[model samples]
Target: MSDNLKVVENATCTFCGCVCDDMNLTVDVDEHRITKAENACILGKAWFREHGIEQRPFALIDGHEATTEAGVEEAAQILARARFPMIYGLSDTTCEAQRVAVGLADMLGGTIDTTTSVCHGPSGIAFQGVGESTASLGELKNRADMIVFWGGNPAEAHPRLFSRYAVTPKGMYIPNGRKDRTIVLVDVRRTASTPAADIFVQVKPRSDFEVLWALRALVKGRKVDPSIERRTGVSLAVLEDLVARMKRCNYGAFLFGMGLTMNRGRHFNSAALLALATDLNQFTHWVAKPVRGHGNVTGADNVVSWQTGFPFGVNFSRGYPRFNPGEFTTVDVLARGDADAALIIASDPASNFPKPAIEHLKRIPVIVLDPKATLTSRLARVAFTTATYGINVTGTVYRMDDVALTLRPAFPSPYPSDEQVLTAIRDRVRVLLGGNRLPAGAAPIAPAVAAAS
Candidate 1:
């Protein structure tokens, strides 16, 4: 350790989608490691402290250690030779790397999707169906007087959400902060976040759609069956009171999470909640936002939406972008054995995906690019041990509330960044597939690169 350490202020922490940007990092220049991270959450501190351990080969091909160039070239050859290829996992990387991935899909005439396809894909589908009424965290901090947490355990997942933005933050309109806010938690069971709520509504599991639909009907001044209480485990009186209070609030916000999106009804559950939020806006200022899970999943959605004209589950097989969630999503594509080759970056589907999908993924030629070794890397044909995003490379990432913040690197990285590796692969694949030019009718990648910059 050096006596003189490097100090980096205002470095963004990319652990979760919160993107907390006030961290002060102390870096050991000689060791190229983060010694301390001030003003960081537990997750951020753990993520920062674990950087700069690059003991294995920076790149591997067919389980053999290889140079980065040879690995990229082998990966390019595999992707260029494949008839059906799919690229996945941009939630943990920067928009620059994500753009390169989209371009690679275009050049290979394949498909490109993100990690959001597994977690919040249904929310994106519902957003397209009913449109989202969302506001940035700053707006929530300043004006929201009533906050609802539906099926989200922010206390455990997003520890700083309450203190930094939602419930406890002191803003111009919220002079008393938590005292002036009415916090409600709606989940199938009690969670760590329940203690922070002024009121907790525990509904029956697998009945969120029914409850949300009944609430929407109640909000719209329509009569609902009294048996909803028995079906959803929420009394009629409580539902009536909740709806009445929602209408009375000056500003209300509903922050839902995977509880709604990952359930039986999936997209319909999210659509019902979003429609309820929109209906409430008729009487008061109300909005709804999905509680995204990963660090840059929101940014991945933004980049994919603006670049490919769709959110997740986008396909470029016909030399143009086409989207269909269940059909083109990564899990479904692998489960159906549609993708002959897979390029996974910063995600480990092998560990989390269904057995069928994992089986099919194992059968394919998989290329993995990640900072840490994971289960997916063990089965990959080519693996690139890349640098962690915020610790070793700078990029723009959108917070959970869709607020974009520029990340600053705290120290030097021993390995290449995702952008550098993906760009090198994209160029190599393009040359191997055909000329350096993109196929006809393919969307230009320069615009996406420009937007990311």
Candidate 2:
């Protein structure tokens, strides 16, 4: 530390899918805090306001405190004894950690996925069924003549997204960014994202799949009554107008969020969106990207797809990776009370899961590794606190579109990294599985990473 040496503030916005790269940060080294952040969103501001060191690490078991090493050892024992295991949660950590997690799932003969099953699980299904047509944010900013936000309100979820990338700011191809693009919003209610759009089509709740089907019918030239409305409350005229725009645009992109994927129809709704994107390709170029919530959820999907030849919901119980969504997913397994050990990394299922699932988690020997004290960590038999991926460590993350971007740490911490803890567990598993006196009486492992691979 020098008397007059100015600290440089550099960071990428982790608040949304846009992943805004240029934000000016001012730090107070004396207090170890951020003083000012320029060109960021409201969400970003709120996120930075709390540097969040007050969240001390704790190891709890049966609603009481336990030793950290004891917690890890107990968690390892649980995993070692189970016939079926689940290594879930990767929304808040680095892609590097995500990669390690999937690898661990492969080695453990278990399943690995995120909470996306509740959010964009449907979208992923649609993607696997009929691949999405999507583009980079840079491409949207510069070249897209039309942008349709379906089942998403980026104005609130991603505050700086429109201002910095898609609608407002200038770009290479479209100089006067927003003025050059036609923005349309489609939702059941008038939320914040509706006001900014040039056209807003209000549909009824839970009819997104039907609406998409009707739109596809129109695109394909089959006739339909203009007066008949479906569950979404959107009219044929409105659908026609939107269809026209899809035909007229030089290039377009549809950005959807949790609204489309998380409700009654779930993955079927997501599959419709994917089908609509494919239908649009018949007339012109149209793409869709799920407005994923976590900074690197897509990173989890990509890593799993590359390693296991499928995304999430993978089971290796037979010593080989096998993919199944509903049967092998986290919620179903938890509900069935089948898995003996659960490793929750960077997630809070206690808060986010259904009561049955959370109850199952409470009954089992659970291991949680996170950066903060959440309900999930509080219930874990072995809880380990690790550095925040985007805030305290540096690694790559994937936006919803599968674009890899680096996450820069704004500060440092005393906690060991997520990778360190997982690697330790991995080594412990190797020793325990070797069956040579158990390295202090731990259980044995079946196979290592090489055999699993």
Candidate 3:
């Protein structure tokens, strides 16, 4: 142990959606790196250990090193000149940065989308169609006695979810912790998380909609033939028993994942599950929430929804905000070659998007802002190396349950934060567009401008 080490107590880990805020990080100030992360899981430890100030250029333009000022100027010019520009990837950043990005998109009259479009976009759609029954993670931890995991393997993805909040933790009502709670795992196949379940129901591939539909029927006291086992691979007896447990439990929760959203039925599958939770409230308390993947993705959704009146895949091209998923979403717009330029922040779409979207992105003038170099930054026309949130930068990030937590930086960074850089670009774009038309607090569009358009 070095005498010069600095320990930051109760620091937040932004590696995953868990956003565990009880981390104790020991920083080697001389080396500008985190040496120890106590009370962190395997993923959180790796996240804290792997991040530090890297020896990279502050900014780049056309693959050539340049000053941060030059990069911001070029990025502003590119975005201002494009007819149909797009802004994407606000998942990994802070809520402050996401708000600036949304305001920038409004200023440029460009489309703005988040990484949520690819992950839980369907869940958002379903939520809009049929409202969700959700509760805070704290409430579930202290009250829930029956927890069901659907289409998600939290053991591998969210390692601390069970130990810290859901399965093993002792609740007020569940004094016996894991013994008092009933755990149910539903998935297309058995996974690493199967071991944590008292009952694991493996369904046929792409049969989530069928299984969920049958469960809904059973919960509603409707007739469901036993032969449904042939279609979904889950016997009707098990579904009936599951429904009985859901109705009997004092508090129940459904923590679903991408397995239900990205499949064949998409939002319909999510709607069925949510509808079942609503139905279960007649007999007992039940809630459903999508197990988010990114640490700040839920923040992105909240910021965008409040700012633009939509969750993801929003467009401001009509001089006002508009919502349409397939049309304005990042992948769909890129795949269709509609966007002439792009401004990406804190995400890598090159490695994550489809072939058609990647091809179009390569052909366009793309700008990226991230703490580290990524596949998207490699092809960017302008890129800014910003300070990492929850590490070298301080801001507010939303937990998976939409609870905002203030970040405590372990150490300072040499580079600027995303909020500072985006604010500069936005100011430059406002000047280039000819006036201070849309100020920080004003509506996205001026009243007369929106009326005229």
Best by lDDT: 3
Question: By lDDT, is 2 or 3 better?
Answer: 3
Tens digit of per-residue lDDT, candidate 3, span 100-145: 9999998888999999999889999999999989998877889999
Candidate 2, which segments miss by more than 4 Å at Cα?
1-8, 58-70, 435-453
**Which has the better lDDT: candidate 1, or candidate 3?**
3
C-alpha TM-score for every candidate = 0.95, 0.90, 0.96
lDDT of 2 at 80: 66
Residue-level lDDT of model 1, residues 1-453, one tens digit each, is 787698999999888878889999999988888899998888878888887766879888988999999989989988988878899999999988888888788778788999998888998889889997889988789989999999889888887788788999988898999999999999998898999999999999999998888888899899988899899999878899999999999999998989998899999988988999999999999999888888999889999888899988888876688899888899999999999999999999999999999999899999999998899999999999998888888998999988898889887687999999999998887677665334446455534646746
Off by over 4 Å in 1: 436-453
| Ten residues in sequence with the least summed lDDT for candidate 3 | 436-445
lDDT of 3 at 269: 88
Clashing pairs in 2: 122-267, 133-287, 203-232, 204-232, 204-233, 432-444, 433-444, 433-445
**lDDT by residue for model 2 over 1-453, one digit each (tens)?**
223223345577665656666666665555555566677788887666566455475456555666566666676677766667788888767778877777666566667777676668788888888887888777887788888888888899987667876788778878878889999888889998888999988877878878888888888888867654755588788888888989889888888878888777887787888788788898888888788887677777788788888878887776566778888889988988977888998889899788999999988878889877889877777888787766667888787667788877766766766776776676566566653122222225655769847
Quick one: ranking by TM-score, best first? 3, 1, 2
